[model samples]
Target: MSSSDIFIGETIGTAILILLGGGVCAAVTLKASKARNAGWLAIAFGWGFAVMTAVYIAGPLSGAHLNPAVTVALAVKDGDWSNVPTYFAGEFLGAMIGAALVWVAYYGQFQAHLTDKEIVGGPGAQSTAAKSVEAQEKGAGPVLGVFSTGPEIRHTVQNLATEIIGTVVLLLAVLTQGLNDAGNGLGVLGGLITALVVVSIGLSLGGPTGYAINPARDLGPRIVHALLPLPNKGGSDWSYAWIPVVGPLIGGALAAGIYNVAFA
Candidate 1:
């Protein structure tokens, strides 16, 4: 495919990926949403469906490698570096756009969730006490979970390991199954398989770090959370941001290496 096609496809696909993925988080976490407290199973399935939908939509235009890790893994697997930057640009830009759209979609719910005295601890209260124990340990503010993932425990080693492990599983499936080899990236069956893989990763390995198997999925929305003018929205947890970004990258390269040695 041409570079323009790749860019547009990645941009559109990744945006939809984040919009629906982040939308579920907003629906479950925000107070005013009818799906409030819908729980983790809902999130896992929601994100899985989001992946399937985006892949099919953008597949025709640009093979729909929505995640930067997937893009990187393909580059590593094929030993081609030329189009890496284009894919990266599209993924990150789409992710940011998608995140901003989430804020627009959930504006009132966000306001209600953040401004509640019980949630944000009233006006002028900057304390972390109102946040969950995990958020407090991670130094994240209330409502940040809707925008990004945070560790339930603050162990650096375990959190990074979880992300890496989950990503490896995802990339392994994509690489081994030839999911990206189609004229339409991740064709019908491939999209469904990959989506189910994501759900499996989230259900089995997401407990520690919320399974941020995709770097763009986490960091782009986190950046949005930091920039948005949500009332009383707390810190972006910058300290922990590197794990999701770096861990998936390493996992991608590792998975590619394994594919080269074992599958290729």
Candidate 2:
């Protein structure tokens, strides 16, 4: 495909991916939403469906490699560097756009959740400034999980390892399963299988670190979380940002290497 086609396809596809995928997080985490407290099963299946939809839509143009880690892994696997920057540009741009749309879609829910008496301020509660300060000091944030992932335990080594392992599974499966070679991109069956793999990873390995197997999926939304104005949204937790990006990348490379060594 032409560069324009690749870029446009990835942009549209990743936007849809994040729209639905992050929409689930908002539904589960945001207050006043019908699906609030919908729980993990909902999130896993929701994300799986999001992947399926995006791949089916964007696969024809860009192979639907919406994650930077996936793009990097594929490049490594194929020894093709020409289109890496194109894919990255499209993915990141699309991710940011998707996150912004999510904000718009759930604006009211975010406001309610952030300004709830329990979260931000109350008679016995801290002021917004105090909350922000305290959260920064503690390296914590509120309502960010709707947009990005965070660890439940906050163990550095273990958290990083969890993301890496999760992403390894993701990239390995995509490399081995995706029919990116056939037709324009992921075949219909590949999309379904890959979507199931996403759900499986979330159910099996998502507990500790929220299973951020895609760098763009996590960081783009995290950036929006930091920039978007909402009442008492708390810190973006930049301290923990590196792990999700770095770990997934490492895992993608490892998966590609393994695929080349064993499966190629």
Candidate 3:
């Protein structure tokens, strides 16, 4: 594929990915309907499936780097560094746009469930309250709200370490499965690998802080959370944002190091 064609394919494929993956988050967390938490497992699987779909669609064209970490890892692995800048730009921009669409898709439900007055107690009390109310109203009754990485006021080292480890595992899986040519069509294997990685990270290390292993995934959606006129949206939680970026970058580099040593 030509450079332009590759860029466009990646952009569109990534946009679809974030739209579906992030959209599921909004649907479960922000939507006011009675079926709010009907599909936590489904949401997780949706993300895995989204990756599969995006890869199938754009892998041939631009390698389907929907995440910035993936782009960085590819650069590190192949040393084809010239396209790094372009790929990063496309992935991040596509993530931002996808996040915006998620906000739009769930805007009405969020507004209907959460009000301005309920969101103004302590730090992030608004988001907490909104999430609680959304659950109660939907009859899901106290579903955990979606996780977010907050300021580094507490457990900075632990959080960063968790992100690093989480991202290392994620990248390792992608390298072994995502970039592999298993001849028998590795799409399903790749999807399962991603799902298992996410589930493992969420179940084990997702206690104190949510795992934001992908920098673009966290920052892009956080940007939308800030810009969207949701009822009583809290601060974008910018303070803890850097860890996701730095941790993933470090983790991807580490994974590359390990892969090079072990496989190269």
RMSD of each: 2.3, 2.4, 5.7
Q: By lDDT, is 1 or 3 better? A: 1
lDDT of 1 by residue, 110-195 (tens): 98887777676755544443454346445787877877898888899999998889999999998987856644577788899999
Which pairs of residues have clashing backbones in candidate 2? Answer: none
Worst 10 residues of 2 by lDDT: 128-137
lDDT of 1 at 146: 78
lDDT of 3: 0.65
Candidate 1, pairs of clashing residues = none
lDDT of 3 by residue, 163-230 (tens): 88888888887887646342222365565566577766656665555667777777766666666665
Q: Which candidate is the best by lDDT?
A: 1
Once fitted onto the true fold, the runs of candidate 2 whose alpha carbons sit more than 4 angstroms away are: 124-137
lDDT of each: 0.88, 0.87, 0.65
Per-prediction TM-score to the true structure, in the order listed: 0.95, 0.94, 0.79
Error of 1 at 47 (Å): 0.4
Q: Residue 114 in candidate 3 has what lDDT?
A: 54
Model 3 residue 232 CA deviation in Å: 1.7
Candidate 3 stretches with Cα past 4 Å from truth are: 38-43, 116-153, 178-192
